[model samples]
Target chain A: MFTGLSAFPLTPMNETGIDEVAFTRLLKRLTSAKVDSIGVLGSTGSYVYLSREERLRVTQLAVEYSEGIPIVIGISALRTREVRQLAEDAQKAGASGVLLAPVSYQQLTDIEVYSLYEMVSKSLSVPLCVYDNPTTTHFRFSDELHGKIASLQQVRSIKIPGVPNELDTAKERVKQLRTLLPRDVTIGVSGDPYGATGLNAGCDAWYSVLGGLYPDICLGITRAALAGLSESADNQSKRLEPLWQMFQKYGSLRVVATIAGMQGLTDTPNLPLPLQGLDEVARQELKNILSILKNEISLP
Target chain B: MFTGLSAFPLTPMNETGIDEVAFTRLLKRLTSAKVDSIGVLGSTGSYVYLSREERLRVTQLAVEYSEGIPIVIGISALRTREVRQLAEDAQKAGASGVLLAPVSYQQLTDIEVYSLYEMVSKSLSVPLCVYDNPTTTHFRFSDELHGKIASLQQVRSIKIPGVPNELDTAKERVKQLRTLLPRDVTIGVSGDPYGATGLNAGCDAWYSVLGGLYPDICLGITRAALAGLSESADNQSKRLEPLWQMFQKYGSLRVVATIAGMQGLTDTPNLPLPLQGLDEVARQELKNILSILKNEISLP
Candidate 1:
């Protein structure tokens, strides 16, 4: 369930709150694309920006709408108590797994991060994915720390951030991580642009942001990479270089939310407050890029 | 109101929830010490770990127990809506002011941060202090960004993390910052060890963690520095070098919570979980250091 491509969709919101209609539309797209898992409330899903009740509602909505696809809910919170509660809520709502990150205000120690996983893992009946997202969470995991966390009974996957741009170095990095984690503990790649390289580098899954909106293309890369067609996978991903550039330049959340809005899949200003959607220039640029991509590449 | 020694106390918690008795006792200590402001739910107060209801309750408690002393509530949240709500709650609860940090999960852009402060500042009736603690919030403010945020109407103070250790360099940094801020906006320094030097360098306030526990000693340093007795203030702070060392070694939150627990002001495991108190060895070292300090330094 924690393998292949885990499509992370945004929990689109309008002023009234979580846009259930738009959220289900995104989920239906991922389900139809047959992505291996649907990851809701990941950073791309804006989990930390949500209240517990809203997060739980999103969880239920994801499970209900994914059409039998595995649901991995991001259950990261600053408070351990809240993380545990969210983990339980995700399990109760029928999520296949929960993604855990050492989300903190006080920069957490390695021991503190380990303890967080240990405590949450014990309570979770479902599998827990260690969300090693330093860009957002600000907690970096050493290989030794990863080894310790992976040793926890319920921790079944580690979603790493981007790998090195160079394929050889990416492979070497993945190999090093593999030795530290158990064989059953899958290594998933995040940071959307690095998804193809990481998958070709022996990562078992792609925990992707792009996969949320354009699952078919992400899956094209994931399938080719997993089937050992490195060049084919690279070409598929390279075709979307324009989208990748936008993700890097304006942040994946804002860039993707902008695309979703332009596609009419979500309301304008879909992101939560404190996160403004892209400006007119960036939005126009994205619109141009989207039109070009639609002509240049096939998207479901 | 946003000047001098602003003490940040812990909202000491037991397993059940916020220990009101211990919280009020800590509040009383700050009140009796006559610290210039009582800063509740600041990082030292574990605001990020608290729920909105708990935070609102803490805000009211601080206002009630502060006994006419100015109350500065830390109204930081991951979401802007929540931050605005927290600001409104603090103002309605009779807090003298509110402090805000750009608490984010999706590492914020400068515009997003500025927009956050602008929106919240518009909603706030009470004065707002800009909290620039990168160690926790992971948001580094460029001087230009500070100038932009300080331009907002409700912004009355800036809580800088630390100044340089050398008095001259510290003075230069403060002077540079002062140029970017409005004349009425006070500059407060955090990072406890640098408190005396920052004040001597012309910071108007000390947003202090240690002051929350031992306000008299912190006040000793604050008073001497503001009175232009640089050497005297430095020496006063220098006397507590041992405690400062511990704070640097372990985090201030854990070390101070340990002291509070040992002093019977809070329950044994005072910090919210995932943040364990000091281990046995550190606790023993603190015990010996406390005993020695009691005999050497004049502490209240």
Candidate 2:
């Protein structure tokens, strides 16, 4: 079962391409945190924008720095064959598991979606985690469809946003799913800020997008929750609330990247256009929030 | 500079893949219609769903059947590098030009989007057509950005959907752009039904999704418009109204593929997943409309 916090680290890039120095600095910072697992090449990491060679380099960097920590590699593309190739590459890089999202362009049929999971899962010996980010992929899998995916032998986990409509239903679904799936199968919650609620609702694990920047605070909240200290977890969440609010105020996920840059993990919070980085006002607000958090939260 | 009717031919697939027989049939049907040009491996042709080799095969097939006809190949992917490679391949395959969409998944900044186009355009010897399909690509290029792309030497055309909001403004923008761009540079419309209106407004050409199913009808409409016979053109468009209404009912562009399948151009009207084939009722409706059109119109 999924437990503790999984941090999805950003893949640093520059004009020459993959910034190994910046990536190494990020990896070192993340490894120092008490995170349960690390995710590489996910949407937050800008996996889709990378070349095949760049993807491999980033995956290898994550795995190497993981030391003994589990690494879940993101393998998503517009074609199944390319995704399969990515999965193989991730496995070769010694990633503990792979997260696969459906090809975005062609809204695949339910049958094709099932086959996609089946093919990728079969290709790798490692456990497979389904990454469903409907906002980006534009392909939403119904709960019934996810039920079918959960039935696959190699599919050991699911990484989904903790949307309100499906949160409770997903909790029950996962419970029902566990009966038919392997005991090790886990349901992980993404979309931070709602992660604690999802964790309380019976998700196996919760991912922290802001954890790369504020590891101690995120880990504290996760630790409190795991210890069944609801009051302490609630306190930590409230203390971290303002920082997360900065993300919301910025109006996009790129704000999370901006905050990471403010914390010295990345050189610039630059996102590819038509998604601009945090404007000056947003960046100043983010800086103020970071300063307050630094004074308040105990270092990891 | 962009005007007239352009056909996007289906990249026919069989059990072995790349069905040259079906492709030849489609090419023959479209060429005889005297379509101004042919667009290969676009959304309708399932470009993102194809493998690199398959994309090459489709490009080669289109070039061969072009028989001196202009063929514009769609170059779109998550990685700018792959897009550049595809653009190069398209030019090498004897394509008259290339249509490029921005990198999918990540929300691109205007600068990043511009760089992507610049890189792709610079790598290919042939002219590049910047395709803006915001619905699928999730990133919309601003009029300012389009103007910048238009100014690029290799970027010789702009292909935009003929939606209401964009139609008039895009025409005016392109009109001003024509003066800044080369004389041969063109502005094309993707939405076929609105082609005549756009042509009259100032666009150079119209890319047809329906051309594969009813090439003669589309050609007749374009010919009538070119001959300055508005009533004749309207009558031809009226003949297509029934099928177009069916497409409107489905409320998606994928309906074009289903209509193609119904016309016996392909065995399956399938479009990946999430985009199901027309239901029995829709299929029956399409059959009735197509039957009526076949009888009413003198198709070549």
Candidate 3:
């Protein structure tokens, strides 16, 4: 059920509060593109920065406008009770699934990691997707631990990170992960620009950032890979080459925000403090790339 | 005014809420111990995990109970507006200074770092102390950026991290930082077990964890180093060697929470989720060390 290009919307905000009008437009664009699901309040959504009230408001609105689209709300929090609370809130607000990452100020042992998932999943009636984002969380889950989490009753999917430790090895790891876990567990991949290799490896879906911007491009890449059309998928990835280089260089944040600026979507770009978009040199580089790939990168 | 051995109390919490009575007792003990200052809501204090109301409540209690000890409240947050609001609250509540760490999920640039400190410091009447905890913040302040932030009008002190890249070179780095930075900025060292080395190298203060548990031992080491009594300082450090080894092995988190557990301070150790205390084997070792160092490490 947790498959295909799931759009992770960037929460639009201004000085006063969440830019509700801008958010509505973003949601409308996502549903209009016919993405498989909406992953509201993911890291790309700036869930960490928003207050509880504001976070819930985003979740409620995503559900209201998604119009039958499955919503996976990001419920990563610093405490177990808070995580559980966010899970219950997500369920009550009609979200289809809750995504959780073991976010900690200190490193967590495997036992603590298992108990966190167990405790939260018990409160939740909907499915939970274990988000293995070691880059941001600094907590890595071994395959042994992944199996342990997947064995939990409420867990229905695992979001394999799109970051490749070694470019060649990442696809093999995804293939290995596909065969290792329970067949019941859907294996979705995030870091969507890099989604082609994972999808070709028989992963379930692309939990995407580009799916939020222009679902057609992300969907094109994934659908091609799913149908055993590697050449077609490679061509799509080639077109996104410039943006992928930026993600590799300085995270995907500035590139996405800069693209939003080029579009008329946001005035002040709803990024968290101290995380500005591309500097002048990088901005110019981006412009040069976009001028060549303009039709491929632009929204309707 | 931010000099000498400063104590950062662990915020004791239970299922109900913040253990206010225990927190007050913790404050009174610090005041009685005559440590330099009180830093509330630090990493040990679990500031990132806490709600705004709970954080403010702890701040109020720290100020009220602390006889004349200067209070430095940690105001690290994901958003600038939240940081500004906290700084204003700290000033209104009579805190001596506010501590800001440019904590973000998004990696920040030098311009963003300077602007974060600038935005918050401008709203405050009190002095601001910049906390450099890269392990938790994942944001390193290059010496160049440090110089820029220190030049801000309201930033008077910098909590220089004492975590060594190499044990032998840690003190040398402190010396280099002291030389490169402005003479007026008070360089306070954290990672307190290593305080003797940093203090001996001319750091002005010790931002301490053990001081919250046993101030005399930490203060003794810092004062000896300050007085140029190397042998006396070395003895104090050698007495606390077992605890330091544990901090090096794991983080100082489990050991500190374990000591608080042994003291019967609270039913729960008050650590944030997935950051539990030491395992059984480690606890036995900690007790053995305490038994040997009882005279030196004991509180009044």
Give TM-score, chain B, model 2.
Answer: 0.88
TM-score of each: 0.97, 0.82, 0.96
Best by DockQ: 1
Worst 10 residues of 2 chain B by lDDT: B269-278
Q: Please provide, for model 1 over B208-298, each residue's C-alpha lDDT reduced to its tens digit, 9 standing for 90 to 100.
A: 9999999998999999999999999999888899999999999899999999999988888888888888989999999999998999887
What does each candidate score in C-alpha RMSD?
1.4, 4.5, 2.0
lDDT of 2 by residue, A12-123 (tens): 6654588777777776767787578887888778787777898999888888888687888889887666787898899898989888888577555676678788777777
- Candidate number achieving the greatest lDDT relative to the actual structure: 1
Model 3 error, position A147 (Å):
1.1
Model 3 C-alpha lDDT versus the unseen true structure:
0.80
Docking class of 1: medium
Counting clashing residue pairs in each candidate, in order, gives: 0, 15, 0
Worst 10 residues of 3 chain A by lDDT: A162-171
Q: lDDT score, residue A62, model 2?
A: 86
User: Arrange candidates by DockQ, highest first: which order?
Assistant: 1, 3, 2
Candidate 1, position B155, lDDT: 94
DockQ of model 3 vs. true complex:
0.67
TM-score of 1: 0.97
Q: Top TM-score: which candidate number?
A: 1
Runs off by more than 4 Å, candidate 1: none
Chain B TM-score list for all models: 0.98, 0.88, 0.93
